[model samples]
Target: MMGNTRELPAPQRGDSWNTYECATVLCAVDGCDHGACQSGPFFVVSISLDEDKVATTIMYSSDTGTWSTPASLDLGFIESDISISWMHGVLSGGALHFILMHDDARLGVLKYDLGTSCLSEIEPAFEIQSARFDSHALIAPEDGQLGIARLSGFNLSVYWREVCHDQVATWTKSEVIDLKKHLLASNPMISHTELVGSVERTTIIFATTNIGTYMIDLKSLRSKKLTSELRLFNHPWALFPYFSFYNPDKLRTRSI
Candidate 1:
């Protein structure tokens, strides 16, 4: 709720980032029983408000206009927090790829041939535990990457990397960059994931319970002050602002 913001038209889907895709994240607003939604280039997935059950749709946008009703992707049971990876047409020859990860350990990555409308699972070298794969998700193709930042083992700040190529595999641990103990403490909000952007190069945005809003740069492994504090009203209970990706320049953000 950025107070009485001008009404926005229901978003027509956005253009497909078939080019250099920058990492982007879509998270749930605090306290909405409607679960949350996360979208990648070709897919948008969500879960039941209170159930572990999940559903996903096959979708693509030629321009930043209308989003087709996403086609549901079938699964064994149900789950959430899905991450997708697409081919550059460089290594995989123009195929769309995605990884459906559930907190309960169920994970699968599928490759879809748009021309043929065929889907197949190409298992990875590792089991690819979805839970361990940081809840804070990001898909930044423009910056040449996709990743997430989270507090591993409680306090150490870390992220998972997406390996895109002919060698195709699961996410791998990144070079560990430590956050200052004094400046680093995980927030209690359910949305306690990392929010990063490349105003120049991903200066991450996170609200520290102690310090208010913070900006961290993963490329330089540096952290700095952004704001003294922000008053987020009626934060919708469970909906904390654990951002997966951020680009304040390209879009409008609301802060109450």
Candidate 2:
């Protein structure tokens, strides 16, 4: 078992992204369970138990301070999977979306909706499988819709969800960009690659090839080399700035 870190506070109402501050506290969970993604605004957190059960803590923050409490969530189908990805959940459409891995190696999404206070699983539009343990992510694209990006061989494919008023969302393939041709043009030593981060509301996807970091534009199918001085091929993680969707004037008047 390991010790918990100090409580991570949300940004202050009027504080700048670089200057916001919140309180901190010890966060100890039973039996060293796993925790995933912090949903924005309400700041809900999901923790999975050793026995496939899942629970959540709804966090509250303001200029005054930060606090959390147990929240009632229906963690549907959380136990049906073999394992959950360590990747942080993506927040879109009023829910925190997590990528789930089945025992057979198929991938699906589990959504915890803050507004409805419910948890549900959304299957991919097609069979999205990974021979690797973790190789996919749920992204909120520039269109403000939920989509999944998967890496297969040297190609990256993105699919978006098309919602029907009274029916389940239908997934459609929106883009398929070949990374091998683009990366080979810049570096011939490129071999392995993986999706790292999706930024600009996912209009851009950052990936690490065998030689360096690269970015792909979903709209134009253009690719660019970000850095070639360092070999970050094995580093599967990245840091991305928070996406702010508020007006500056109105944000100044609100409390964190």
Candidate 3:
């Protein structure tokens, strides 16, 4: 499992009005054996937006133990109108994908490539772009490709990014799950549903409803209720799923 020991503080810049956001992604450690703990060589990417709506990016490399020089992010023509979402980013295709919001509405996605240190924009599916922000979530499938899951009323639609022969990327609707028929069968009192979080490299996604929270597997349409007592209310995007594994060998040989 990957391990981190140092606390990475955000780079200081701008005044009190600056909005800062950051995300971390594990890097591939060279020549490392299986079951080894990788503590370094990862990346922490921080993005800051000033009052003028200009965005700047700075990256921290664990190998160098230092932050890179901040560079202005060219958001193209829409730079003045959009802002990056604070929601946890989805790592796919060796890039960190963040949601873009325009005046409280979902615009699309922003892609920050780790290898090239370049930024790009990804247009969301038309159906997804028109839906409410909380109803959809960006996900990374097991194949490490970019994908999205949207919950529209009682149905859940999933889309995967596909590249055509012309090298143009498009979103293909893969499948739809009938949530009302499946979820409402057991609990008929479920009023509203919203997609919250997803497990990276897996088909597992978490959703919240007025009744409870559920963990659903997109492959088999199987679901399990994680909690029923805690209602998320209006904050459907509050849940963030984190996965980690503990090495039993280290635990068994501990000095204490």
Candidate 4:
């Protein structure tokens, strides 16, 4: 019932990294009974990435303890289709966002504010099954921007959008832009996840089954693969993205 919390080791390529100390947690979004524990400012939800039904639910890890109990959600629980569920997403800037598709759930998108841990239904539920939650919920740089990708069966597509302030409604509205093509040319979002939080020189990094881990460096319009020493699976539970940061201050300090 105890989940693991690990930080990604330093990059072997001598890649320079920086630190902006923060805590992280991952959880299973499926209706699984998997427990979760966290060490700092994060929690993880466990869910089955390749199965159907409630029997596949697993444990979630927030910090370093067991989430024997998940705080009850106050909003309406619009049950998604039997073939749909939320297994993977990201936590950043006190906000937790995930892609919610399918007309059955009644809510197409959902974003939870970590500072409040309150759920807010975004838009009318979408009409797709088992889509990538992280792909569509990726936060973009330049601030207030977000990117999303969708995976329907063998088809995969990516999209880019920005969040703008709505004065009359006091809400941020979505505005799609011409950043990248919807990579339907091949399998893209299939079991892919965006890096939670952000690092300098990069907006998102994820690994796909057949196409090694792809780095989405928004700084430059190009994607690169980092060596081949690591092995990644499509399973959400096994997909661990540990980000290591280097700080000159930490190097000078005796204790980190």
Candidate lDDT scores, in order, read: 0.37, 0.59, 0.73, 0.37
Show where candidate 3 strays beyond 4 Å: 1-5, 9-18, 25-40, 79-81, 132-134, 234-237, 248-256
Better of 2 and 3 by lDDT: 3
Query: Taking the tens digit of each residue's C-alpha lDDT, what string does model 1 give over 1-256?
Result: 3253222223233523332121222222332222223332222221111122223334334233344453334444433544332211110223344544445544454554444445455443243343454423232333544443444332433344456577654565665554543245433432232332223124343433333445555556555555544322212122233435444457876899
Worst window of 10 by summed lDDT in candidate 1 = 85-94
How good is model 3 by TM-score?
Answer: 0.82
Better of 2 and 4 by TM-score: 2
RMSD of each: 12.4, 11.0, 4.3, 12.8
TM-score of each candidate structure, all chains considered together = 0.43, 0.67, 0.82, 0.45
Error of 2 at 67 (Å): 4.6
Model 2, span 1-256: residue lDDT tens: 1253335564333323332111111122322212321221223254342333443424444323554443434444544544456556676765667676667677877676656657667878654754454356678864659888888778778888889998868888855677777778777888877777676356777777667777777777788887764344454554443543433444445468
Give me the candidate number with maximum TM-score.
Answer: 3
TM-score of 1: 0.43
**Ranking of models by TM-score:** 3, 2, 4, 1
How do the residues 1-256 of candidate 3 rate in per-residue lDDT, one tens digit apiece? Answer: 2363577755655433235655555655654332445553667787755556666667887777777776676655663367666567887877888777776465688777877777777898887777764477788976878888888787888889987899998889976789987778779998888777788888888888898889899888888888875465656556767665566766755476
- Measured by TM-score, how close is model 2 to the native structure? 0.67
Segments in model 4 whose C-alpha atoms lie over 4 Å from true places: 1-87, 101-107, 124-137, 140-144, 150-201, 207-211, 226-237, 250-256
Give the range where candidate 3 is weakest over 10 consecutive residues by summed lDDT.
Answer: 31-40
